[model samples]
Target: MTPLKSGTQFSFDLLAGALTGRDAARATGTLHVLGNPGGRIHLRDGGVICVESPGSPGPDALLLRTGRLSESEWTAALTTGTRGTIGETELHVVAMMATHDAAFTVVAGEVEDCVFTPQTLDTAVAMSVAIDPVRLLQETSRRITSLLALPCSLSPHRDRVAPVPGADLHDLAPVREEILAHATGRRTTRDIAFAAGRSVYPVTIEACRMVTDGLMTVVAGTSVIATAAQPLVPLRPRKPPTRRPPTQMPPTQMPPAENPLPEPPEGDDGDDVPLPRSLRRQLLPKLFKQPERKKL
Candidate 1:
């Protein structure tokens, strides 16, 4: 299918123009938004049946979180109901909500491209409820406005969150507590919502409040990114090696001085000598000298 390029500010009119049918009948097909973190919207008979994206929480999340349904209940909805207890009405509501959130996510941010795949659905056994494209767009706008008004430190949908030190959990709502339980600083709001089986909108709103109350803190960038993964940069260069001068042999050693004087004769036993070693050395020549052999 040919990809339809979208502008920076994505609008409902733009999406409708690209995905609507010629006869104006319910456009039945899937709308695929292509980008770093893209989304998919399923239309049955011109009404939105389902919506999904990498960044937004899914329909199952909403139902499970709101206590509207359990994991088994949602699983049952997907089946033909031979053993599943969930009814068609509940499934349709879940799908409608999921689609609304998905559509908002798709058009709220910058879209790179879009593709619509035309197809038909067998509605005989399954319940299909269609949403008006115009209404869907309006709701998306309202959601965005609400999120902008929140006093959040980061984008609750994209930023990872963790509970702060000395967090007060005594009066927290059940939903907030659940979110806090999973706020490990590794999971984004979207991830926590998915894990808790709750909708992204409510979870995000709660997360924002938690942050404002100092119960939780954002771990990543404050703003949102288009892609699920960030781009990698090249490594930094290393420092250059240093040079050193060659070593030299120390100067040749010199012998120590000889003994200043020989030992005194052993028989001399100089009893008359009373001077110290130093004085004896000085006066030895005079004291031991004999009269010059009668030279006189």
Candidate 2:
């Protein structure tokens, strides 16, 4: 088995930005290529878990060894040319692992140096196991395979920052330049938030939203941030239902309640009387008057 190498040294900010999926190749993060194909990748907290690539026979076997694809994903990719299609949710994490070679792609943010060769299902499985558990869960939910899709058409935009989808420029404009300035493949979300005098959650949410909108990109495994321009994917507008005529209702006066409460039992005790025998006994000693003691 061969260990993966770091692609580049990247900060959390750059990684976050790249993961946002608006840019391509920020070059700040390190990508370590394993000498062998189909290495296992391990991740934690949305980061790489680890990778293992055992040297063995056949290119297909090696592809399987990467551990990125499921049996079905592999079958689809080998048979159909496209297996794992990046959807809206997974793109943020998937785009972070983009590499020069189209045959290999990062899965679950961690498993590394995998090639989409046939007969390598075992390798792909192993690689997937190496990914971070949380990310793996997310990828699994989205049905992403470990194998790289052939003739990969998806590429990160270069250089310019694209607008985040559904994000208003007016609201973001106040911090826009600062975000761009600090996007230097350095700085963590905490650092950026502190510098911007905002909470980390809001910043992170905004950053992720922006990435989904193709306004930014992140380094593969680092926190470095960068800007990239992207073709805007238009959102489909929802149509409003046609209004219906209001139904006429006859006006009526409300009837007053005859009684707010039912009368107590005819032989009811005082309002303060205890409901249970045990409770009455407990209160009886305190409430009942003791026989007047005769003057000594």
> Can you give the TM-score per candidate against the true fold?
0.60, 0.19
What local lDDT score does residue 249 receive in model 2, on the 0 to 100 scale?
52
lDDT of 2 by residue, 1-296 (tens): 00111221111112223332222222122233332132333233334423332311222232333454456775886666554753333432332222111112222123323222112122222122223322322232121111111111111111223343354445455555566456554554334544554433234334543555555555444422323322211112125545656785554543422222222332312122221222123222233333333455
lDDT score, residue 1, model 2?
6
- Candidate 1, residue 144: the lDDT equals 49
As for candidate 1, its clashing pairs are: 26-45, 26-46, 27-46, 61-197, 61-198
**Lowest lDDT block of 10, candidate 2:** 1-10
Candidate 2 displacement at residue 202 in angstroms: 1.1
**Position 8, candidate 1: lDDT:** 17
Model 2 RMSD in Å is 27.5
- Tens-digit per-residue lDDT, 142-199, candidate 1: 5544554454524544578889988777887787889999999888776787788776
Cα miss at 108, model 2 (Å)? 18
